[model samples]
Target: MGRKRKTKIFMIMIAFVLFLAGCNFNSSESSNEETGGSEGETKQVLNISTTADIPTLDSTKAHDGIAFTVLNNVNEGLYRQDENNEPIEALVTEHKENEDKTVHTFTLRDSNWSNGDPVTAQDFEYAWKRVMKDASPYNFMFVTAGIKNSEAIMNEEMDTEDLGIKAIDEKTVEVTLEAANPLFQSLMTFPTFLPQNQKFVEEQGDQYALEAENVLFNGPFTLVDWTHEQGWKYEKNEDYWDADAVKLDAINAYVVKDPAAGINLYETNKVDRIVLSSEAVDQNKDDENFDTILEPEILFLRFNHNHPVLGNKNIRQAVNMAIDKKSLTDVILKNGSTPLDGIVPKGFFKSPAGEDFRDINGDFNTGTVEEAQKVWETGLKEAGVEEVNVSINIADSEDHKKVAEYIQAQLEDNLPGFKLNIKAVPFAQRLEIEKAIDYDLSLSSWGPDYSDPMTYLDMWLEGGSANRMDYSNAKLEELVASARTETDLEKRYQMLLDTEKILLEEDAAIAPLYQDGTAVLMRSKIKNLLVHPTGASFSYKWVTIEE
Candidate 1:
């Protein structure tokens, strides 16, 4: 899921002369030929730009989108997303489920790690248990906590060895679940479900996954060079199980924080693609290479329940109702993002009856400025406070800073006796502060780890890992827990709907802002690249460079 939303901020002006002189192209491009293309031609290299440095590489600990994108390319789980974005078998050749759906058996397809060791079923069992350890801070543990005894093992009530998964033989692994879960197969597609080489990890200890050489890969690419705060390179893994299907010889990504630097790199042919800022979008709307893509991520205002002002339910409701989402999406962003009225992003999930979730919920708590001001006054009186001052935490990106500024002005001007403060910090630092509950409010976001609405709802449960704001409601938690085990399709759907109503409409736990839709500029020569709306956002397995 998203830790920080993707918004192309205003580019900083860089010296054009220095940029041109730093990157010099060889006159004889043919001499550099080797990795890809027809035999003697120059190798196919795909270069791209990312907004920030990757926080971590460990599959068991990686949670942010940037880390997940890199992990998805370097590691293969039980299943992988195909070209159509549907789950297809990757490491497992076949699988069968018991009649009650509590037990599942999978037969492994023979594969090798980049280090030349045979990938075995034990690797999967080991990795699963590793993340479920009580000391680990893995955020998505609940996604798999339905596995038999997983909750007990994670809580330390049962030993890790007592958990449900067992390696029947070198090629087979069996898993028992606490109950029937409809999303089990889809959960296998995530990076957390990936198999890890136990011996290698144990050998490296604390240093594992810190660098390219410390770990092994079984997917299309092998991470070779990772210079923190600089960039990383992914070279094709010739030993990968399906190497023949991977086209690009290498994928190089640079941590380009400034949009202008990214633009310079793209124009000089150093990078193949770069997402553009609002200014760049405006200037290049008619360019054939420019396009806008919607992401299944929503940005929201998370209020800390520990704060005196934020603890008041009416204050939270008034804040949610005041904002003009249309202005934020239309005028401020100008990047095709849709204003959100629900926690779940539009076009993300469809029910068994084939109806969209957002379409069913409609709009809630999106009221006029006048209505918000009245509610604000009433809330202040009820809380017995003359004036309230609160700080809004945000990422230290140009786009995020602008968003904070807009909201600060909106609330101060529209709500009586309200004062706003702003704090902008680097993405990594922001995460630590949010976890410490060091702010009154924060501009936060989430993208589904899988395709289920549970990905969004489960995080707000009383003691859920991602609920850093401390927001909670007993009824909402009950509904979410019941939805997990509910067998009837219609009943499950209704439970989810009820959970949403309680969180957004009744409790006003969070302020819904808008769904992210990003715009980018790319070289037309890159082909077969995919940007999926859920799970790992980008897939380059089939990508090819055209001559």
Candidate 2:
């Protein structure tokens, strides 16, 4: 969060256009408020809005931010990030690591799934195996790559049972890794590492996690209702091991794509918190309820290498440098977001020696606009094309369309004869489009899964599931592979730095537009609602709705 900027006239134009289009906007979700409570009483419930629909609640298949947000609330892993973003014991009492840091052992707390089944160490063992064994539709198995035999299991070269995680006893779980992973403990905080009740899963079969009744919760909340794309509701879990710490009785979330609609819900006192768009921010920065949230998220353009023009390195570099990111963020997105020139966002992580990584390896391809045009001309010639027709795919959200239109205009205006097409699809469809690599360029953003540089760097490995662009570089892969096992903090940091340079400066894998920052109108009465710089966006465990 930072000081607010003055509104630009162009920002108002964009908002006007959205309103003229007659975008659909819903009111809000109905809540369970006490009818006969005391005069000073208020219901411990939070009403929030999401920009997109959750694709899945299945831990092994969910990869989007929306799904992670819900799963983080309903599932407890071995560890969870506290208000300070520090790893704290959740399901486990404590964890011990060997000197080499390849082996980890965790002792379980006497927690229970919502179904009355005692949570056991075997639950984690089953979840890890499930992710690796079923790497179809989604390959979240890559998240557990560093674990011993995990890669082999993912490749189908070894049996899932051969994975190096074991339940020594009903209450003890042990994990072994192929190399020393500095971020192993931190990774446990991800939803992919959450435990699963095998019996419950098998019984539910294909219907598992598809609806509120299909999923079982072991975290601070339980899914009481789900209405698909509309929204969902979570009630505080009475069976949670730390249920006493959960202050909120219920939380309701709605999917509101139009920022204008979200603001309406907030104004009418139907929602407690609403994420504001740039236009909305300009209109409401003076409000005492407005708060800026700087995120460790980066918005970028993913180039599908399958495209004839995009496959050329020169073409990719030209596209990367041609755009004016400053104009995109300042003029198009007047929110707290800042233009970015690299994959990793600034202030996301620091070296063990305590220096900003962005400072260490400044901006890349940050040359003059004139230089960018020259390269673009040369790239067209190299690709043997007089003009290139490209399509940029993006989510159908109001903010996403605004940014996409800005990029489309920039490319067409700066690079002569460049024809751009914009494909705006629903959030769920956009994910499928990306997975299929069905477009030339994709507007995408990534939030860190854990507090490590590897979370971003490893996403583009040759055949990585997250590498929607299909970009690959032997040197970048080598550096990433080396860094994964390097116990020396300094050396590992250097390798990570080198990998970023290769991806951004040398290869131009993707065009990094800006670092995401959210402008929110949260009710002042809500207390202890924590947002982390990384991992999950909101934590409701200690949150209370006070009068």
Candidate 3:
């Protein structure tokens, strides 16, 4: 799922710092005394805060970072991403490929779910077939992976049982792909591919994964508590196959949208980490524990192409060119985020020619006020309208509210005859509205599911689940389709590059805003939290809290 493919509006905070205030140390001292720990004793508890509550725990339905991160920790997939963001065997003991490299088989390792059910190859087969049958939001991932018959099954032309995946035995699973995909291994690290106990899911039925108790976990940690919209808790899974590698005994996560409240929690020894808002960043950048993580997540304005005003290509181009992305990133999002004119973030991928994709594509829709005014006039003329009223849906977080306000100002001030409205709602509600195409425009973001340009390029596929913008081009679809199955590395890269051009430059499908950079405060005692630039974002399996 690229930052589960639908990035949520939450900032991840991974470390912490002690407050110099003497009285604040009382909580730490009390906690240490309660644990009977000395100066160098290892404290097995981790405390952190997320900006929003997790939307869901169902692996097949999770399409955002919060859910993906939680699912990644509580469920074991065939493969897991190591600290370096490379695929490492997790539930799978061994894997082998046939002569054509299309047929692959994996041997399951001895592992058990939180409820004591054995993790088996059949669990994987059941889970994968379920994803196809349900038409999961991430079903396109299987198609992108070139899984044999996956496309046919998704199109209802073939049965889910014939989707080229099978449990050859209790411990062995076989998978046949339409073609050899270099990224297939990496794709396994995503939460969407995590195995599910068939019986447990069938028993839970409609209530499955709605809360912590309803779901079974097979990863390093098992969700112990989930208080919707408030917080959640996790405990180390003692039954895990590699429990010895797990360091943290418990992880307590809270939904602290207010930056000040999060900082207060950190200062009072209640939490170990908190992400800083732009203003908070300025105030805490000199602190010893302050840090910044540049993510592949890209924020943009998604235009509803089905709408009359936005349906006009000229108006979309004008809207794209009118915004001052530089000011938005430099002023409002001062946490190292850079203005972006393209969907793919810089440093995310390099082509077969060893050049950055961003550099090769250059900038698009970057225009001055004078240039924008001309385009806006042309657009209004083309639409035969004196003015157009539009609203942008955004998460009600402080950061998003500020960004949306700035965008609202930019578009209104720069583009004549444009009236922009701001609609602020909770994060989960905002996602629902956008998915339903119930808004005129949406402030959206996407994090790569993998380290491939295709992660970003494929989202705009004509009728793709992620294509909520109603933006489509026959040329863009053709290029992406060909790029997915093209084995020639250079040719595939070129196709992706062309696809991006058609999506951004020609069609102006979305107005690129900025690449995300998270500023955070961390405690020096925390070690090896394992933050990835893409995918699930954070891994706590090896995180340790040292004195």
Candidate 4:
């Protein structure tokens, strides 16, 4: 559902990179005769920009927002989020659940992939089990969703065939969960759960999804051209089950890392949308088309617990306290971003008592530099060292680099002998290094995979897929484990509340920097484009262009 809130600032540092990328689309070629629009005749074309390239198109391996946004448009899932952000059936026409709600059966409507292959229930079963077998970066989603035997399957304790999913018939798919999960249907909307054609995938092997032609599409649009580091094109899929609902005939997306270049494209009418950086925001704030969205994405500092210097709780707490979050958000990140002292962003969740999670949990590590110095000195004594030198790995984007530099300066200035070396690398490479646990600190971000708090809380579990920080806390782990199956709303809510307390205030496991806000300029003609707070970022199924 659209929770479009207007704010003063425009643009997201991390999400900006996800949504804009390079393209060679000619502006003159965008308009063409297309049928079906509120206006008798319309251009029926939408051009946009993103800063980073899609890492991979394969749904199984897609871990970044860039890949998720692209895959979500080109592929259909059992369920999809509606404009209101609620789960609605997509490929599935009907669904039934058993009394205990551990088992779910879905009946599909007729659909075909871009290659004219029938989309069957077997595809869903195949794709899901394949994620487990391959140990995808998002494999833990199955376990968090409470899928039956998913934990064992991911851990190699059980065969993937034993997973709680099967194709009962040509159009019927069934799933069994270890416990009744209320978010199961919503989880179906996530990109990680999208179905894949088994035959086509096996045929292409490693080449599958590496290029536009190698992939098959069953959603509203099919990716027709992908020029590696350049841009890509999406053409309307006539065979889509709900093609009639898709208004745009084509969408041309490009990679434009430079804000000035993106603004130039927008000014020249070459592109319909462009996200502004902080500097650009000041120049464009007076424009009528300027808009902003407070996304449910949080950028935070991840501490590698395996590192000897970082493993010290005092050091981690000092790191969290040394930096001035208010200054970072107000000055450096002036695009409506808010300083976040808690891991969970505001407005994302409410307790059983109807209180906002952030309101109830309050803030952590909002102390002054003097307090940070005290903690840093204590940490130095405990570690038997005079000073500490650690590197922070970050995405190689202008915005991220600026933020990392600010953090480096803050730690060095406020924490006495602390020295922070920033290692800037491509986004995809940064993810790889973090996954291998090779970095001391990492500037990372997390967007909700689902609406539940577990999406953020579960990652810190002893061996959770996203626990690249190597953090382990028995109390936090116990709370998450119990909350997963705790049916009582009040009790479950309390467990989660306590979990955040232990994570931030008690353990200082990670330092939360800010919650992102997206500022962009969009052509007034573009209508009905859905920007989701979680799962896939954007949906173009109902987008339209005016005459």
Predicted model with the maximum lDDT: 4
Score candidate 4 by lDDT.
0.88
Each model's total of backbone clashes: 0, 0, 12, 17
Candidate 2 global Cα RMSD: 5.5
All models, RMSD in angstroms: 5.1, 5.5, 6.6, 6.0
Which ten contiguous residues of candidate 1 have the minimum total lDDT? Answer: 23-32
lDDT of 1 by residue, 1-547 (tens): 3433223221222443343233222111321253525675546788888877777788888777888789899999888887777789998998999999989999998899988999998998898888877334453454444788876665568877877888899999998889888778877777777889999999999999888888899899998777776678888889888899998777778777666677767776767898877667788788899999888899999999988878888899899888888898788787888899899888888888999999998887888999997888888988889788999998876667777887888888888778899998877778778878889999997888777788888888765668888888899878987888888988988898888999988888899999987888888888999876667879888998776
lDDT agreement with native, every candidate: 0.81, 0.82, 0.86, 0.88
The regions of model 4 sitting more than 4 angstroms off are 1-24, 28-40
Q: Compose the digit string of candidate 2's lDDT tens values, residues 476-532.
A: 988987887787899989999999999988888888999998898988988998887
Question: Which window of 10 residues has the lowest lDDT sum in candidate 3?
Answer: 14-23
Question: Using TM-score as the measure, what is the rank order of every candidate, best first?
Answer: 4, 3, 2, 1
Off by over 4 Å in 2: 1-39, 136-145
Give TM per candidate.
Answer: 0.92, 0.92, 0.93, 0.94
Give residue 104's error in model 1 in angstroms. 1.4
Q: Which digits, one per residue and each the tens of the lDDT, describe model 4 over residues 1-547?
A: 3334222113343333344333444452434543334555666889889888789999999998999999989999999889998999999889999999999999999999998999999999999999999899999999888999998987789999999999999899999999999899899999999999999999999999999999899999999888876688898999999999998888888887777668866876768999888888888998999987888999999999988889989999999999888888888877889989998899999887789998988899878889889999999899888899999999888789889999999999998888889999888899999899999999999999988788889889887779998898999988998999999999999999899999998899999999998789998999999999889999999998874
